[model samples]
Target: MDEKKAAILGEIPRLRRYARSLLRDRDSADDLVQDCLERALVRLDNWQTGESPRRWLFTIMHHLFIDQMRKVNRRGEAAMLPLEASEAQAAPAEQVESIASREIIDALQAMSPDRRAALVMVAIEGFSYAEAATILGVPAGTLMSRIARGRDELRGLLDDAARRRAIRIVEK
Candidate 1:
């Protein structure tokens, strides 16, 4: 593969992780990543030659994710079962960690896509605020606001989840 193609290929793991975090469904996330790679390769020339393609590829993915969300909204698609109903049996030793991870992901899923993307890019992906803003096509200030609001939203959601869990334990 050419250098540019190689660079794009190298980012697949990051893209997949980001996509999974955004969509919260492995199959859908894989499709989104595939769509993103297809678009990126087809428009490869549009990428600036010397600059790193990291931000460029992520921008493409963010745009595509938005488009998918819009299409889903218009269709009023059916909802899938949440993680709890579909969760597999894990080893007892891993249950607590698994539940905690699922709670965090579920909270992320509950956020609006814009705020979730903002949080994921900056906090999870370690993008700078400015870089995430540029990738998300928002102003820096807007990105910061989204991150703040997202953090608060996550806290509230997680707290609610914890309370529910505690109540269940106490009721037992």
Candidate 2:
């Protein structure tokens, strides 16, 4: 494969991860990633040389996700569903991780889409502020504000969950 094609292909996992974080449903996320890849491939010639392929692909995914959200909102459909446990039994360590993961997912879902997207791009994906801003199509200042607010909101959500869990433990 050419360098450009190889670079695009290498970004699939990151794109999928971002999509999954945004959509929260495995099937929907996969569909979104597939759509993004198809679109990127079809418009490959339009992509400027010397630009970051990962950022370009993420921008595509972000726009698609926003479009999907708008459609769901127009239809008055609920965007998120409760997280469900897998059927397989987990070991103790796995179980702990699963519970913590679910808590974090729930907290993330509680955030506004913009804030959640900023958090995912910066904190989860480890993108630089400028790079994330480019991918999100927002000013660097706006992106920074969103990240700050998202972190605060996420902190509050997690803290509340912890308190609730503590209450349950105490009551039991």
Candidate 3:
């Protein structure tokens, strides 16, 4: 494959990972990745030379996700947070870590898509604030606001979960 194609191919794992985190279903995530790759390939010429394709591709995927969300909203379907189904079956020794992980993911998924996208790009994908802001097509200050609010919301959600878990333990 050519250099452009090679670079785009290399980002599939990251794309799928982001999609999975957003949608919480492997099949949907794979489809999202495929759609992203297809769009990126068709618009390959639009990708500038000597710049990182990661940001460009992520921007495209983010738009697609927003479109999908709009469609779901129009249909009156409720947006669901990713459930910790797999973690629920963890062995005794792994349960603590599993529950913690589950709580974090649930909290993240519970966030508004805008906040979740901002947080994921900066925190999980390791994008700089400027890059993430550009990718999300928002001003730097707006992106920072989203990130700040997202962190606060997550802390509250996780803390509540911890408190509830402690109550359960105390009751038992």
Per-residue lDDT of candidate 1, residues 1-172 (tens digit): 3988889989999999999899866778999999999999899888987766889989999999999888876786524434343244232453345678878887888788899999999998999988999999999999999999999999998998888889989999
Q: Which number leads on TM-score?
A: 1
Which stretch of 10 consecutive residues in model 3 shows the poorest summed lDDT?
Answer: 80-89
Question: Lowest summed-lDDT stretch of 10 residues in model 1?
Answer: 83-92
**Tens-digit per-residue lDDT, 1-172, candidate 2:** 3888899889999998988778655778899999999999889988998888988899998999888878887886644433232222232343344667866877786678899999999998999999999989999999999999999999998898778779979999
Off by over 4 Å in 2: 79-97
| Decoy 2 TM-score against native | 0.85
TM-score of each: 0.88, 0.85, 0.86
Give each prediction's root-mean-square deviation over alpha carbons: 3.5, 3.9, 3.7
Q: lDDT (CA) for every model shown?
A: 0.85, 0.83, 0.82
Candidate 3: stretches off by over 4 Å: 79-97
Q: Across residues 3-66, which tens digit of lDDT does each residue of candidate 3 receive? A: 8888888888899889977865567778988888899888888888777889889999999999
TM-score of 1: 0.88
Best by lDDT: 1
